[model samples]
Target: MISPEERNRTGRGCLLGNWVEERATTSLDKTGPESDIHKKGHQGILTVDWSSKLEDTSTQKSAFTSSKGTSAQQKGFRYELMKEHLIKSISEQVHAELTAKPAAAELHSVTRRDYTAGGFQWVRPTPSTDRDYKTDQAITFWRENFDKIQGVTAVRNRDAPFKKNASFTCPITECLDPNPENDLDTEEK
Candidate 1:
């Protein structure tokens, strides 16, 4: 549930966007709300965890910056209880469609930070002016969010160095060469 603080900040034009990408699970009670809800055996998922970090080099906001994080803006929430319900629900839906498979649930974090910032304290994005996010980043967020469930592996942001983080994925780009001193990894090169 959104809080009073969230409402106030959002009213001031600082919006909140939350997204999730979890692997599909085989546990009946784990997928949507359960902590292990996204345990994989089926495929994957899509959801929001929006922020404003984007493709800016001046303010140093790179496209690699995440839009989602622990939403430490809400005051009080029953994460465990909600997690339980969410897992059951997502599990039901996934299995209902393909009765042969199993699933579980988990809730995205509603926990908030101590300092009050814009709704979720999302970093002001490159297009800091883009509140509604007309048709660019929001669209990419929507597309990438869905792509996870579609079983599409994440590709590296070629402009960014190959590295890993707790949030986004860049599994295969580690071998790319920054200079011609090393062999190129793909035909595109």
Candidate 2:
């Protein structure tokens, strides 16, 4: 004997551990609005055909299940695309290098001396002695005229030489200067 206000508050009736609401037992009537069937349909009692919903869900599940195949195909396509791009870039670089002129620093010719048994052995070339005859003659002329050059001779006694001067005598020697005035001036002040 619940009041309408109490029924509205609880939204439905509960009796003996079972739902006693009339809406809970009523089957969905197809003649009703399509939106009412979806909103108010009771579980196991709804007259609405669920096979269509099941079909839609199965199609979605199938799409999800086949994702592995699609992903593999996508990966293979991406790999081939990347490989083609790399090859094209490499070929372009090689073509550019081939068409470009060699730099001045890289254009020099390298003389490689191969030390292999059958290869030509490189040796230091010696200049001919005939071309240097003037140098040798000059050296010989200097050697022959060395004794003729006027050079100072070494004296046996450094204190006495071949030519003696009055200035060369010791300060104490009276023969250095006979002038008594010059001798007195030569003494320490």
Best by lDDT: 2
TM-score for each candidate, following the candidate numbering = 0.14, 0.16
Q: Give per-residue CA lDDT, model 2, range 72-172, as digits (tens).
A: 45557789999999999999999999899876775434443333446567799898555655433344554455446565342222222333344435466
Shift in Å, residue 143, candidate 2: 32
Per-candidate Cα lDDT values, in order, are 0.45, 0.52
Please state the error at residue 156 of candidate 1 in Å.
99
Count steric clashes of candidate 2. Answer: 0
Q: Give the TM-score of candidate 1.
A: 0.14
Task: Show the lowest summed lDDT stretch of 10 residues, model 1.
Answer: 18-27
lDDT score, candidate 2:
0.52
Model 1 global lDDT (CA atoms, 0 to 1)? 0.45
Error of 1 at 71 (Å): 9.1
